[model samples]
Target chain A: MNEVPHLMEHIDFDTTFLVFDLLAVFMFAASGALTAIRKKYDFIGVFMLSFVSGLGGGLIRDAIFIQAGPPKAVTDSKYLLVILGAFVLSLIFHGSMHRLKRTVILVDALGLGAYGVVGAEAALQEGLVPLAAVLVGIFNACGAGLIRDVLIREEPIIFKPGQFYAAAAILGCGIFVGMVELGHADHTLAAILATLTVFLMRILSIYFDWQTRPVLDEDDRS
Target chain B: MNEVPHLMEHIDFDTTFLVFDLLAVFMFAASGALTAIRKKYDFIGVFMLSFVSGLGGGLIRDAIFIQAGPPKAVTDSKYLLVILGAFVLSLIFHGSMHRLKRTVILVDALGLGAYGVVGAEAALQEGLVPLAAVLVGIFNACGAGLIRDVLIREEPIIFKPGQFYAAAAILGCGIFVGMVELGHADHTLAAILATLTVFLMRILSIYFDWQTRPVLDEDDRS
Candidate 1:
């Protein structure tokens, strides 16, 4: 009985998990800010992208679930600070980051892994069912990127010819749920397993040049 | 006493509103399609801009109020059909609307008014207080356009030096509630008054070069 209460409290204030989530958000925000900077987006656009890329997914998920408040990106000042930091950093190193294609892709893969794991973890913690958790996780991982693409008036990456991006997120979420079921809910193990699963899938897809066929609707079918 | 239910049911299925809302959505979708074509956006971008501009505001309002699925646009197939019609029309007369700057703004203002009224009425019906209702209405009216702006990576008209676009929306909605409270619940009269109010405000602003003051952080600090 005592152990149950302790576990509940542990879930409430897990400093390690919180720090891990923040790190994931920071990585995602940095990538988004860098992309906006490269596109020559003005200050407001860059700020908006940085904020959205860090928080858009979570906001969508929370809104869908009817969770109260404005999501973490709005509620937590620290997240905002981190995004600002990333934006400033991106501005300083824009030339180098823009030049190295390999480094950029690597950072993107890391961001994908981190966001995927964190999203799945949030869903599970919120007591969502496994299937819903996976779906939410996928959205959490990709929603910001989708918004980024749409704002740039580009076709979303999901609809583009590319390596399996969404599939990696889904895989990571699935692995996370499986690990939790097997009682490996420790912070380090969860992060490592989920990140590796997504990162490997993304890398393999890039290596093999895997792509999903686009849905083509004939003109004037309407 | 029994007349209350009959009134509620009548208002719930007000056919005049149904027609006006559809017309407004069609007009706005037409503008979005034209913009997309002018920008030479791909099929997805064109389709997305049209969809977002048509439905984005209502969706935002509904989400803010924690209302249930699909909102107005998603629930009605006519909204989709209207957008498709607009897209087809744009393709046919692609060069024509591009040169008619004054005509474009007039049509856009009409659409904004119509959508703003719908948003205000919906919020009132949903039991939001007057202040909240007006806010919701403004959000619904401008949310789609804001999304369009963000997607196009332009400074949103709201954040730019412009006439009080959002303020106009709020004024329309405020009048709508006041009129309804004064027993002007007749759909046609309410719609006409509210829409005219917004349209005139928009026109006056444009003519006079009316604009909101910008927020200067340095000035504030001083």
Candidate 2:
């Protein structure tokens, strides 16, 4: 009898979306802060890395959305709060938290999937071409991690030989765009399916140790 | 009689701006491509790095400008053509060109100054706060080089304890914004003054071997 809103203290679609977005931000920020700790960065560096890792991709996506107003990452205070919270937690409990590798990987996968869907949806809403939408989705999924690695003076993991990372985002984004093109007008359903696809693909790729070789490898064989 | 336009074949503000922008793009792209060659990257990687180094800062600045349309680097054909032209030249003459280290340094300084002024002016036009405009100018001047260094898996030179790079941008941007705040509404004069300030400051810094230390260095001393 439509009591879900009352039971959840007036939960709505936007509220649910905000919850997922916050979850993604928290996970990404935690990972980034942990990396900073491992790298022995100072407090400022830790905070900066966490903030960028949590919001950098969304900022890039929003900036490219042409019609979108000022980037939410810059205008919204909540993003900073989330990053700061994550940074504090990471700094305090890093030793114990570092052992939860499996949990961290799972959370990271979920964040990637959610962000991919969010990016793709935003691009489509802005009337971007399908290919561009897919590209945006992939960027939203992996761009933060790339920035984090770069800031730590390491090669970006996605660009190096690694398990399926960006590829999974590409596949999921492609599926979402294809569904919309093929008359699936329900954004929620498409996003759910695409997110699930990316999450599962990323998990399985990690489990199976999938890898992609560089183009230079071919030259060596020849 | 006002014959300036006629003497220049109806050349307008945009045309002159384009000339400077193209010069910066060519120099930055050529430098990036040369780095790629030294790193032994594949052809595709060379082109990609060249494109990013030439245009990444402008893209970031435009993306941040709330009222600006889509980034010109993405929408304009001329930027891509210029990058491609630079890439070809670098690829063909990399060996001989690498010897012109002094010339490359001078050209890079010029590009930095030009981009700093351009970015500050854009931010001011878009109604950003003076501090934000100055920050944007510094970012636009140094962001591309940071990206290039990161892509090649090296510490960004600006971040290291080295010569004054970003500081020069800050000084120039500050001067431009300050002039504007003092009611000097002539954009052309402001830009020219700012550019010359950055150029001269950069040259002097290099010549004098100016340096700044990291915040953590004090802790080490204690």
The lowest-lDDT stretch of 10 consecutive residues in candidate 1 chain A is: A213-222
DockQ scores for all the models shown? Answer: 0.06, 0.14
Report the lDDT of model 2 for residue A151: 73
Return the clash pairs for model 2, or none: none
| Segments of candidate 2 deviating more than 4 angstroms | A1-16, A41-48, A63-70, A73-78, A124-132, A177-185, A218-222, B1-4, B7-51, B64-70, B73-146, B155-222
Q: How far off is residue B42 in model 2, in Å?
A: 9.5
Task: List runs of model 1 lying over 4 Å from the truth.
Answer: A1-142, A148-222, B1-13, B37-40, B182-187, B207-222
The clash count of every prediction, one per candidate, is 1, 0
Q: Mind giving the per-residue lDDT tens digits that candidate 1 earns over A18-46?
A: 66567667766777888888789887777
* Minimal lDDT window, size 10, model 1 chain B: B1-10
* Whole-model alpha-carbon lDDT for candidate 2: 0.75
lDDT of 2 by residue, A4-85 (tens): 3233445454565566778888888988998988889998988889998998788777875444778776687897798889
